[model samples]
Target: MEEESWQSITVMEDKNGEPHVLQQKVKVYTSGVSEESPGYTKPLMKHRIVPVKDIVNL
Candidate 1:
C-alpha cells in the first residue's frame, strides 16, 4: 500500500520562463501491504504533510 499525500506545489516563474518548484515539507509514507511484511502494522515513521496555507503560520 503506497500512501501518497497530495500537496500544493508552489512555482515561481523566472524571466527564463522556467517554473521553479519549491521544496516544501511533504509526508513520505513508505508503506506497503501489511500481509507482505507480516509484522509491522504501521509505517516505521509517522509523517504528516504541512499544508501550504498553514505553513505560513507555523
Candidate 2:
C-alpha cells in the first residue's frame, strides 16, 4: 500500500457522536483537488480524521 498524502493529526468527537473537525492550528493534507471535483480521495469532513473512541461511544 502507498503512504497517505495526509493523516489525521488529532480527532475530537461531540457528545452526540458527531465529529467536530478542528481545522485550526492543525496541518491537514491536500492534493489541491476540490472534493466536488473528480479523483479526490480526501474526506470531505472538516477534520482530518475521527478516532475510534468516537465510534465506540457513538
Model number with the top TM-score: 1
> In candidate 1, what are the lDDT values of residues 1-52, reduced to their tens digit?
4443434445555566654444433444444555355332222333343434
Off by over 4 Å in 2: 1-9, 25-58
lDDT tens digits, residues 1-58, model 2? 1123443455667788866544323233444555444342444434444545543565
Model 1 bad stretches (over 4 Å): 1-8, 34-58
Question: Candidate 1 — number of clashing residue pairs?
Answer: 2
- Could you say which candidate leads in lDDT? 2
Worst 10 residues of 1 by lDDT: 38-47
For candidate 2, list the clashing residue pairs, or say none: none
Residue 25 error, candidate 2, Å: 5.2
- TM per candidate comes to 0.26, 0.24
| Candidate 2 accuracy as TM-score | 0.24
Q: How accurate is candidate 1 locally (lDDT)?
A: 0.43
